[model samples]
Target: METTPTEKKSIKNFFAKLGPGLVTGASDDDPSGIATYSQAGAQFGVKLLWTALLTYPLMVSIQEMCARIGLVTNHGLTGIIKRNYSKPVLYIIVLVSYPSITLNIGADIAGMGAVGNLLLPGIPSFIFSLGFTALLMFGIIFFNYNKIAAILKWLCICLFSYIIIPFLSKTNWGAVLQATIIPSFEISKAYFMALVGILGTTISPYLFFWQTSMEVEEVRQKKLIVDKAVIHGMQTDVKGGMLLTNIVFFFIILTSGTVLFNAGIHNIDTVEEAAKALQPLAGNMAYALFSIGVIGTGLLAIPVLAGASSYMMAEVFDWEEGLDKKFHEAKGFYITIIISLIIGLLIQFLGISPVQALLWSAVLYGITAPVMIAIILHICNNKKIMGTYTNNRISNVLGFATLLLMLAAAIALIWFLLK
Candidate 1:
């Protein structure tokens, strides 16, 4: 068989467009995200589906801004902050964020272990957590950026299980369509909390760091990287990725809303519970498929958590960083990844529930999401950095709107806690 180079190049070019945005978007549906979205559907049904619609454009604009920062300046988010901002400001960001990141890594690992326990009887979640921890660490430490990115891009397919589970259930598409198009408000503690969780999981602060740093990595990989191809060209891919992100977001809520919520099973206390709830309504095959998603997304996300954390520290401390860098060349960077995972694993041993760990991790990130959004807007708009590449009128407007939405969520979260 004779194959044309042009045909091969076209195929190569198609895959080339996928990078940080696709990986970051897929990782958004990590174990915690699944639980949160499941809980949202079980507890409120289609009530909070609008949050997906609301946050989609907001997240797209936000991530595109991050992608630009990395491409134009050739520095990670923290590196840009380190150079422009005070040391006190930089350290404060890291100190506050590091624990949350560690706890989340730990929670995700435990959740992955729980999925293991579900699939393999007689193996406890705690034991599975330990094994998953080692396995994830091995991937991050051993694999280069190209290898890691390639693996994650494929793993993105696992999120389709969440998408498929909905189809298996009985959905009231009329109500679903109405709820999605015409927003409804619920004035209650649970509703606000769920809203907060949804926003936190979607427009995550760590995603900004991961997005910018990976773009920097992309630049470093191809020294002659075209900003047009890699930066501005990212919007099409970024939009596609984020739309997929929200579509999965929509379906998870739809699945649980149709199945569990309708069955009057509103109290989905954990990922395992969510999986179990699916069976009675959607069948064993649905349950099995859901559990597989849990494992798939967990494996896909844990590295992003570890890598984003490591990239933050390495950039801030001026230590060598990047999954592209070999282990010896980036010892401190790699060690930080190990340290985060270890500390994350220790949280499980400390008698903390993985479900609580996951939610609390989201809340912690939710608190700071607005602040990070503000900083990102400032960075991208500064002509000193972006030059003509600065965010245009449209970007600035949407970016600030996202900031305002996040600020309101943070404030509402506080009001709920205090009351």
Candidate 2:
């Protein structure tokens, strides 16, 4: 009954392989992403399933570029941008990202609190959200990077609940397959907006900074700063994480498509609504599983959202930045973290629907994503910055294509908003 050395080695190797990429992918399906996917399924049903299939490769490719830049270069994405780009451009970048990240933080807090209330019915969401905000600040400000990573790795497991939900419900796999392989939707403003949201939540701009910075952190952890080691195993790691992310996205869509849409419930504007709707279709277990999953994933995601913003600001101002450092060591860095959380919490108190805010946060990301993606492509391909790490033909093709795709989405979103 005792485990052999080979088994233990395999277990150790399996865990060793999952690092930044895994955390990045897991963080992608945060509360906002969940709300977006839920809305897509509840409103459009199987028609939008093709998006998950399409974005899988795009997500992996774009993230790998960011990861490569971080691994090869000595600075984070914004650090590179600040050094090379104009100050006006830098200000513009921060201004654009400001609303998206901040709104997302608020919406995510509502989401985490909403799920917490579901699990602990005695607590009101307002109180729960405030408590959660305090908990997140304490953990990040006091805990070391290693401890935070360890905790996030465990929370990542909750996302698989979505994968389980679809199997519990009756699924028309034939229809699901057809929709996934072949896109079937008209060209309308609504459709364009939905497309934008999907892309925004999937290949988001915040992810670019977080992944890049984390890769640089990985290098620092291994004492490879002087060696400037060529990263060998990260592609596999990133790809595996992205694959899991897309799989979660796909199933969440499928679950709603099968359960909510089929039941003539087409609108899901809140986490509570979605949870309530899931009960009869997927049963009580699925409902409870989903309720807990969002809370856990929210815990994991909130920091990433705050960290991405903090990292960007720290790099822009040239302040000492890193989750590795304590509050005293990086006062501005941790203060930014506290302020971000406080602002997000305040937004939740305003008379706005949390789920709607979550959805709109994705829309903002849709608008901002193209601008960042273009810069990322430029930064990753520049020979001066990346040196031999410059993107190859495949990476370039996919990277540029991702930029073009997001650009088109941004343009479409603008044209519709104007009308």
lDDT of 1 at 290: 90
Per-residue CA lDDT of model 1 for 1-419, tens digit only, reads: 77799999977876678778888888888888888899999999898888888989899999999888888888998899999998887887787677777777877887788878887879998888888888888988888888988999999998898888777767778999999998888889999888988888898888888988888887788774655655655786688788888998898889888899999999876778898778777899899989999888889988988888899999988898889888999999999999988988888889898877876777678776887889899988899988889988999999999999899998987888789
lDDT agreement with native, every candidate: 0.85, 0.84
Mind giving the per-residue lDDT tens digits that candidate 2 earns over 1-419?
A: 99999999988876787888999999999877887788789888889989988898899888988888888886888988888889988888887786678888898899888878877889998898999899999999999988898888888898999998888778999999999999988677766777777887898888988999988887787656423234556887798789888999888888888899889888877676788788877789999988887887788888988998898899998999888887888999889889989989988788766765765676677777888888888987799988877788998888888888988877876677678
Q: What is the TM-score of each candidate against the true structure?
A: 0.95, 0.94
Candidate 2 residue pairs in backbone clash: none
Task: Give the runs in model 2 whose Cα sits over 4 Å from its true position.
Answer: 1-11, 225-230
lDDT score of residue 58 within candidate 2: 91
lDDT of model 2, residue 158: 89
Candidate 2 Cα deviation (angstroms), residue 138: 1.2
**Candidate 2 global CA lDDT score:** 0.84
Alpha-carbon deviation at 12 in model 1, angstroms: 6.7
